[model samples]
Target: MTAETSEPPAFLPGLELSRILYEEGVRPVLDAAHPGLAYAAARVGSGSEVLGFDTARSADHEWGPRLNLFLADADAAALGPAIRELLAERLPKHVRGWPTHFRSDAGNELDPVSGHMTATDGPVDHRVSVDGIGSWLRRQVGSPTAELGPLDWLAVPQQRLLEATAGAVFHDGPGTLTAARARLARYPDEVWRHLLACQWQRISQEEAFVGRCAEVGDDLGSAVVAARLVRDLMRLCLLIDRGYAPYGKWLGTAFARLPVAGRLTPVLRGALAATTYPDRESRLCEAYETVAALQNATGLTEPVDPSCRPYHSRPFRVLHADRFARALAATVTESALRDRPLTGSVDQWVDNTDHLTSSRLEVPE
Candidate 1:
């Protein structure tokens, strides 16, 4: 992003740019310096491009030709530094018209290591990260072993899980990255059901509040409750399809790709846009039934009527979503997870970035 060049190269998607970097810039260096060196190369962690949703504007920072180069534990310790040094001496000044050299994105901030693109004549400080797959996975999901327990799955954030699984793997010479990705691709059956039940439990707790707030003449409170339910419903749809919901910045972008988004989007928007209580209740009820039917179609549990009924002793219409929650919970066969509380995972109850990013997150018993 340095002005040393007239301007940065016209934007190419980040994943594709990373692929070109490996093939043209990094591969030739490896092929010559350490022939037959076994490694796995990929663009699999922490970037908008990894998720295939990055736009032209993403080029501003933390967006360029970058990828993870994974090696065996022993090789990583023995040769990682040498490989990095070799790339620095040999990689082209430019690849596909973007600078191979990089510098810190922060103009005045600390952390001096270069992390963004800029033109340079000196040995280009590059971003070809080197480490073992196990170490990388351990840093990512807290468990180094391939076999992740139920508690392990609960501890890792959904966003991190998405980062580990979404991006393309250009090579797997170590013969383990693909398997590792597949293993982390989705939650186990029992855990998924538990998540579904907990999502429904969330809705059951609040679906009546949209109407009750308006009943008490708190239009603002009613609108706020309606928006919260809309968000929960969207997250539930994501769970139903087995997609990991990204952080709030990209939740709707991810949800828009779901099969149910076509019909569900309008009902959800209607609920969010409603000013009066009647319109909010009507749209919310429509959404409730739509999602309920979608859940029933999965055949995960006994089908509950997807109809809206009055909240007991009040005129507010509700889905009594606990019917879905209890039915799904009944189908859980995993003894460790059965009869557990409705909290699904760390991300379910907590949204703190510091906690979500930590690899040492403790799972509650």
Candidate 2:
């Protein structure tokens, strides 16, 4: 049997698969076995559903009928393992033709019985993990609680935050998980401005380099700079739209959802694809002006003219992004935030997955 639907036999999206598991496989058992047990159920973390980018191919591993059930700390400790054991015997063998038990690897060998995906009646290490919300948050992000400070916000990876808050919650018994997610929906207004300022600062630092490199006959270097500018510009758009920018895999996908994406997508693509130095420069200048116009429309700061001018003492035409950065910084009322270095958030500067995912990251004071 396959996980086919009336619509088609195509791979089920992670969200749909998760919902089926919750409604058909988990909910009924919980109601019968542990009725009135307060818990939260959701499908989040590292799945395409969390990012809403899953395809049929995503079902190959770590996919299918999986969920997280968050209970009180004590209740979880006492009942979590038993619930897992019960669900292992009770859940349907194939949820929409997808196995509830994932195959596991043991000691350099694929154990069919212990595989991450296996049939029921076997020793099933299920994916329906049970834990307290605090433990869950602590594992997903550093802070177990939601009262995150500026440093905490800066240190937590945007991708992780996005995952933590993105997917659908099937149930929240005490509303704890929902409230925590609300707190992380976005940065505070002041922090948003600070990040925006730093993003602009980044663009300003490098906008001139694109032309400087080209002038030195380093067309390759010029192209590289242009690509970086395009990335920063896309990120800036996300900030302006008050959206969290995911990592590279979904950067473009997330960017496309922004209101400005339709106008800026072609320009950004042209900037990256341009081969000649002059062509690259021209495309980048256009992109910069477009984003500058977007910045002005927000009215977050004193509107600067959305046009390119020649870099001082140089023939290169460029957008003076520092002007925008300074304008945004001026709107920040917090002296402490304004005084901090404009390095932006962790995702802004760090690219390594291991570093971003580490909860022990130290945020600069």
Per lDDT, the best of the predicted structures is 1
At residue 251, give the lDDT of candidate 2.
Answer: 88
lDDT of 2 by residue, 236-349 (tens): 998888878887878899999888888889988998889887788888888888889988998888789889998998988888888988899888887668788888888878
CA lDDT of 64 in candidate 1?
83
**lDDT tens per residue, model 1, 153-186:** 8878888899889989998886788888899898
Instruction: Output the lDDT of residue 65, model 2.
Output: 77
List ranges where model 1 is wrong by over 4 Å. Answer: 1-5, 105-114
In TM-score terms, candidate 2 sits at 0.93
Distance (Å) between predicted and true CA of 31, model 2?
Answer: 1.0
Whole-model lDDT, candidate 2?
A: 0.82
Which pairs in model 2 have colliding backbones?
101-117, 102-115, 102-116, 102-117, 103-115, 103-116, 103-117, 104-115, 104-116
- lDDT, residue 254, model 2: 92
